[model samples]
Target: MTLGREDQPGAQGSSIQDGERDSPSAAIPRLETGIPRLDYILKGGFLRNGTYAVMGPPGSGKTILGNQLCFERVRRSSSARCVYVTLLVESHAKMIRHLSGMKWFDTGMIPDRIYYISGYTALRDQGLSGLIDLLRRTLRERRGTEVLVIDGLESVEQRAPDVLAFREFVHEIQGLSALSDCTTFLLSSTGERSHSENTLVDGVIELTDQLIGLRAVRELTVHKFRGGDYLRGKHEVEIQSSGMVIHPRTEIQFDTPQASATEDRKRMSFGIASFDAMIEGGLLSGSATALLGAPGIGKTLLGLSFLVEGAKQGEEGIYFGFYEPPPRLCEKARKVGIDLDTYIQEGTIRLLWQPPLEHMLDSLAEQLLELLRHRPKPRRRLFIDGIEGFRAASVYLDRLPRFLSAFTNQLRMLDVTTLVSEELDLFTPLIKMPSPELGNVVENVVLLRYVELRSQIHRLISIMKMRESHYDRSIREFFIGEQGIEVADSFRSAEQILSGQARLLAGLQDREGES
Candidate 1:
């Protein structure tokens, strides 16, 4: 949430203004935590001298985030100094030992750059007054103390005699931060902002680890970022060996995609001429297409053809899929004479294989977008095989509509022609659309089905819909000969083509009987 300059720190006339300098010529500076996407969520990191409360329950990664910030502060800047003061009696050695596994932890920065101390003794003996004096003296003793982390703010809160005293303690910490020109991070085990400590701080970053049904989801939210506007929502948060990795929600992140200036709305081919003829040459440039078919059908093969075609034309492409890795996927393409390995080796087409086990929807989208951003050229094609991979990875299945809509819209605006493959029932009498919103987001829908004709099974290809372009609707016999998928003549004599019960039309029957 964004706040006015008045409500935030580092402003000229802010309510909790930092230090004595109110010079008009000066600009409000920021202290980056050096964490990935944390600065992005903070809209250019936290205010330089701001006091932000990092609150969460136990085991919610609050401690890791706090320690990460500490190491990052010193790691990024040589002159940066940090002080980690924990009110809990847990030994700093144990904390250091626990953090040794993390990729960001630097052992050499101890004592000199980042000081680890205990506030438990001071808080227990002399109370809040004594703790405040200790911090004041520490900040003074360490001259370049730019970062201060109070690990057990909840302990300080519980020891306060009343709410007013707790608020006063927070206010005093804020004052000390401003006087010392330090960005303070108060890590507490209080997830809710019901206490006075939340509102008294410059910002509140909350991390929650909760079970949604059977799956445990960890989310991070910037409840209050006083200085500037941030992407407001529950973002995906993960704790790995490196540190915290955050993925801002797709819909919220690309709410307004930057419109590309390229007006080159040309057809993007799938390398198959006859199939291209059926869909009005090919899919319109910068348009999304839904390649819907049953399992074992040519859905995956068709997507590969599209990407391979782009790679042949010197246009960059990305194959973002879940099930098949690069090796297996290239082998599958080789069966159809689609030489994907050559283009892949030449750095024209990239095969991004993501395993379909326990993944985040936004993370996949961001990963694809990151790959796409590097290639600043037009005619960029993306083939997302097994679109259900996204559905499977999402916490809420209902969010697929909004997410796909935003995802495809952003790709289109970037002048990328996108194709997504979704599976249909193998042998059903009626075609069940995979999703209600899948067709709505795409500009074209290609239906591939198996038709039982004359006591034999045959594959038929047809274009169900193509927006803003005239497409051939005749159902053609789809065959996979030695050269790959070839679109044959339409089944003009057969009626009820898609129902798997095709019969000769009355006129064609009569003509056959007469002949």
Candidate 2:
């Protein structure tokens, strides 16, 4: 690690005071990690001159995460330099080869801006002293070294004579980082190591790649961050071709909305006059409505109608679904007298169909919010075909309600009027919501159910709940035909309509008894 370089700012003998914790106020500066949403969760980024531990299982992506931060440091700033010292047996060439496939990896920056070295030889021969000496020399040799990553901290800990010796080594590393004003990341596997290294560090980032059922979900959490604030909890992480992406918990990310909807004072339509009349005009602008019903009961169609009508009124809209492909979705909409393809071609409407596969809940919500944020027009309409798709993809079932609440709040803040379809049991005598919290969180809920009367199945539509507004409470028979979705007169001829069976009301029953 010897490069007979000229004098650098922190070349082992800097004039800056040792053990300088960041300033007391929020004015404490940050060293940006350049990872999307990660910085946001970090409340800015890592504290300047902070030492953090990145711990996880062997295949939990800790290695890639360290490398990504190193490369990003150099790419984001010209004067930034990084040293990646691995104490593992893996050769530097193999690591570089693996990283080359990632979009951000740059070979040209190696050895110059970013230096990779093997610290195993020194650690094995000279023990802790030898490793510390090598790191000091690397910092002195590489001018402008703002970032240093010590990968495979476990190897060094294994070589430590005892926990006391390992704690001393950890203290030495922290001192070096603090004195030199360089952010340091110590990478190691997560477990009950017999070392007090965690207490000596400025922060701890723990990653977990757990197999829940058949799905492998990766999550990240920050256990400790000194002199800095961050969103606490397990955030979803994914390793893609572009590199590592951390999706902060949706509920936490948008706990408070960015902006409010402009249509709060007015109403919007669904292109069906009778249905609009049923809702007293349309749903309140920028409100979320749960369109609940059983399968094959026109939930998706009705949600699409909401977006289609918005598009027709010169409002931008999106049909974000997971069950159908875009072509099939457009075709289905057209079959029900909706010119969905035309609106899509005109750019007034978009069909975003994500296949029903393993998906990160935060990632799905992030994408939808991103699209809504960049729309060309305000008061945009969004219809999620079935939220059950998200529920199926969720690794944590209990998080859906809160996640949906935050997500819905975010949509409203973006001035987007969203309609999410929720499926009930195929047949049931009781009216129940799969997510009871959803009914209370959203501003409105429209119930669509199937009723069997005289050997016929009739589709019924009614507004179950509406807040801050008035709506027709009568349950009406809705039909989807060439004339489009139409809501006719109420179910005046039957009782117990919601029980999946139609029965004669008291008056009619009395007449039958008399006969």
Candidate 3:
């Protein structure tokens, strides 16, 4: 969701005058972390001079995030400096070596714009007070330091003589942060938290990596942002060589502008003239359509035809397929007499491929949104070849409905006419929906199935639902050949086409017997 600067008050870090306390001009001064998505989640960026806590279990990416912020700060501002103090016994050299692999790491900033110091020995030998003294001295000497990151808060907690001492240490750092106008990040690998520690920090961010049925998913949550209305939820985070990439969940404002009358009146062809006729002259321009079918029922071919038609009509589209790579998809399309490779080469179609396993739903949404942002008005059509891919990617199956709803809403906001293919279980006699949630979010449903008749299996297509429009209800026979999909004539003599076992109608049988 896009929140204008006015929707949120300036961060608490900004000093307020008595007369201008409620003035709109008193916006919070922000310190950009250089992580675009994270900044967006924070309602711009972190509050300048704020003391925030980054809490997580070991290897949950606290260190990587802190280092990334530091490197980005120094890279952006030549005068900006950061002090990275570690209370763990890990040597500075080892830490630097680990960071050197990250894209944000800058060796030239070391000992100058970014200072790495170890407080492990002092904290171990002299306790919390010694660590506090070290920080005080560093802040005093480095007056220009704009940021301070303590990489090991747990070390001080372990060495503290008592809870009071640990609380005192946290308080001292918070005071120092306020006095020096330096944004501070305290990284702790502790699962346990103290009330005083939470109370003293201006904000708290929690990172987690947990196994969800053999796959580990990493997430970040904003536990508290004292003076900011940060996006609230568990945001997906991926740690790559470039550093942390946070994808806030898709949140579409309810007040988003409705589609223009012209946009609503427009209809998009599925590249098949007969199919368009069934759907009352094609799908509504910005609507989401679901193509449901069993395996080998030509769902993929239909989706490909739709995309190819859009491309042929001079419309840009995205093919987000989970099963096949681009080259394989192109080869398959060519066999049907459609050259997907040509459209791909001409930049009319952007193909995105994702493997079936260990995929994040939010990541896919973010990728689609990014593509739309770059392509803008001309990019109108989107074909997601596998709906089951999202279902498999979801850790919580129950949230699938909500996620799909929000995702489709976002697509609608971008004015994309989306078609999604869902694979139903094969050999089932009944026509089962791939997802019950589809009934709510999808504006139209197209059903494809194999119907057994007279010892032969024939493919049939029907329009199940068309919201706000008239559509042909007849179940038509279709075939896939070198010329692609062809729909012709309804099964006039058949009954129960949806049951996967079509039987001749009694009237047709009687007439045939008389003949």
TM-score of each predicted structure versus truth: 0.91, 0.91, 0.90
What does candidate 1 score on TM? 0.91
Instruction: Output the better candidate (1/2) by lDDT.
Output: 2
Summarize candidate 1's per-residue lDDT along 1-515 as a digit string, tens digits.
Answer: 00011111111121111222233312568776656677666656788899999989887898888777777777667678888899987888888888777776767777788888899999999999999999999999998898899998989988999999999999999999889999999999886876678877888989999999778899999888775667687888888876777777888766766655268689898878888888767888899988889887788888888988888889898888899888899888898888889999998998888876889888888777766765578889899998889988889887889999888888887789988889998888888787868999998988988766566667778899899899898987777655667877556766777776777676563123210
Candidate 1 lDDT: 0.79
**Per-prediction backbone clash count:** 0, 0, 1
Output the lDDT of residue 236, model 1: 86
Order the candidates by lDDT, highest first — what do you get? 2, 1, 3
How does candidate 2 fare on TM-score? 0.91
Weakest lDDT window of 10 consecutive positions for candidate 2 = 9-18
Best by lDDT: 2
State the C-alpha lDDT per candidate: 0.79, 0.80, 0.78
Clashing pairs in 3: 10-28
Runs of candidate 2 exceeding 4 Å displacement: 1-25, 193-195, 257-264, 504-515
**What would the C-alpha RMSD of candidate 3 be, to one decimal place?**
6.6
Native-to-model Cα distance after best TM-score fit, residue 392 in candidate 1, in Å: 0.9
